[model samples]
Target: MRAWSGQWRPGEGFGEPLPAWDGPSTLVLVFASPAVIADDTPPDPGGPLAGLLEAYPASVVMGCSTAGEILGGTIDDATVSVAVAQFASTRLRLLTGPIGGGTDSAAVGRDLAARLVAAEPDLAGVFVLSDGLRANGAQLAQGLSDGCAGTAVITGGLAGDGDRFDHTWVLVDGRPRTGMVSVLGLSGPHVRVGHGAGGGWSILGPERLVTRAEGNVVHELDGQPALTLYRSYLGDRMGDTAASTLMFPLSVRAPEGRQGAVVRTVQALDESAQSLVFTGDVPQGSIARLLRANTGELVDGAGEAVRRADLVPGLPTLALVVSCVGRRAVLGQRTEDELEMVMSRLPADVHLAGFYSYGEISPIGEHTSGLLNQTLTVTTIQETAA
Candidate 1:
């Protein structure tokens, strides 16, 4: 596989000229800042995206807006980071569908998986990008897993609108759009995909029982108003519920004979109803506890994720690092430390491109995939033989 990556800014444009590939690329992944996606100005005919599509008409171009873009070992907020890869003897397919509402997220995911699997019986892996605020990430991940039927490994993340949580966009073949989900299917025996996820957060305070909940919203915990109990923990920071809650995400563990514990970050807050909206599901009867972490632990978690990915040495690989936006917020000025740690642990020839997302999607076990929050997830793609 051959790969190339570059960054483009508003006035400066791309840092360097586009590469001259031998032929059309198999995949072109574009991670742009929310500013770029929210721009209302007319599209420039000679812009970077247009130039890319014109150059590789046969390629599958897909990505989404991010809280922050990751390129190489650097992290930037207002730039567009792109990675183009050309694979040998690996087949690719792209599928997209509308996520009408949060309630319909599961169905959309199941339908997309079914279509991809039906078209490519040997589908080896899938990378998904969906509207962060509009879809229930937990349900979407579960639906995709059910539809795949243990035939493929799935990984990716939900689109982010920085900390605003107002709007998010996903790009399919053309321009960015809201209320959409896109998946890239990989097939063929030569394609080898490796994925790993880790979060270095420790539980704090006492565990509470989830008494009332609907989808991703927690109405009550331990028979008390969810927001009421959450505010008690925040104290002074309660003024900014959305941002403050990120510092202390919830650690939820399902009932017996179900998936393991997963983190959940606040997406919104209902002051009047005293409810808290999480990035993923917080099922009733699950045990929940607050979580906290430090910079060293978070950075170490990134290294652990790289270790879990088990990337082969001395191979041309593309490492897609999808980390939680909450981690970026917590890391503050030291955010790049995690990215640098990831780069240090990867193979010398690995090309890294990714973004800070609202929620992460990765397999937690051999046959189980789940939505994760406040964690770093790595997905590596390499061609073993061609």
Candidate 2:
């Protein structure tokens, strides 16, 4: 695989958007600030991106935004940083659109699946960058399964505004937008994708009941107000502050008969409303877990995930990472430490790129409900055959 990335100087960075990319490639674009793009107001209709894709002839280009960046050990927002990978033996395509809940979400998925199946590529799977605020995260997955009628894997995360979901954006031809989701379709016979999630939290109690909830807001648990339940979970240790709730996480066990328990970060707590604001929706009647992230544990888990993949014969030529922005909060100034820990396990020469997400999407041993949190999702693809 051939992978590389550099800045986009408006003056010198001349090319078609699609052409910037190369063949059998998966391009990871870490889009810089929407604020920056809006203020500077450069000529971005078709963007250099089209030329990029035309240049590289990519299999897919998957990317999102970031509160921070880590490329070659240098992290900054000024970088229109990008990473590219070329799997010589692989063929791929990118599928994108916005799909809401109810019928819209299913429809979008079916349409995308139809196009994907029509291409009839080997179909490695689908990577998604979505609007967590609106899109039925699951419907897209289900639609792909039904429409495509295949067993390709789906992984990625909610394209969001760091931890603040109040305003999130997606990029289309160098433009930033809210309320839209992007999907990248990948096809290849030989590919490596690794994913892992641990809130650095050890499960607590025998598990508590989510007595009342709506979407991501938990009103009550164990018959008590959800706020009270949360307080009891961490005790006065929260130090009597409003934002203190940020330190604790909700470990939600999917309704009965499901195999995933996701760590949803607490974004806010309303005293008057007696409600808890979470990253993703928590349906009523869900079992709850109060969790924490140890700096070392977060980094260690990420390291282990990459190392586990490293055991494969050939080194990974490219890497795409989706780590929860919430974890970065827990890690403080040492947030980069976790990323570095993950990088430490990779070969220095293996090119890579990614973005921190509001919520991460990754398969848990091939499960249907695979979007998750406080974890790093690493996808690696290398040609195993000529």
Local distance difference test, each candidate: 0.85, 0.62
lDDT (Cα) of model 1 = 0.85
TM-score of each: 0.93, 0.82
Pairs that collide, model 1: none
What TM-score does structure 1 among the candidates reach? 0.93
> Which predicted model would earn the best TM-score?
1
Model 1 per-residue lDDT tens digits across residues 209-280: 999999889999999999999888778866655877767889988766366689998978999999999878
lDDT of 2: 0.62
Clashes of 2: 30
Clashes of each: 0, 30
Candidate 2: tens digits of C-alpha lDDT, residues 38-148: 311333545444444455443455545554444644444433556666566566666566545344765786687678767856776666777656676545555655665
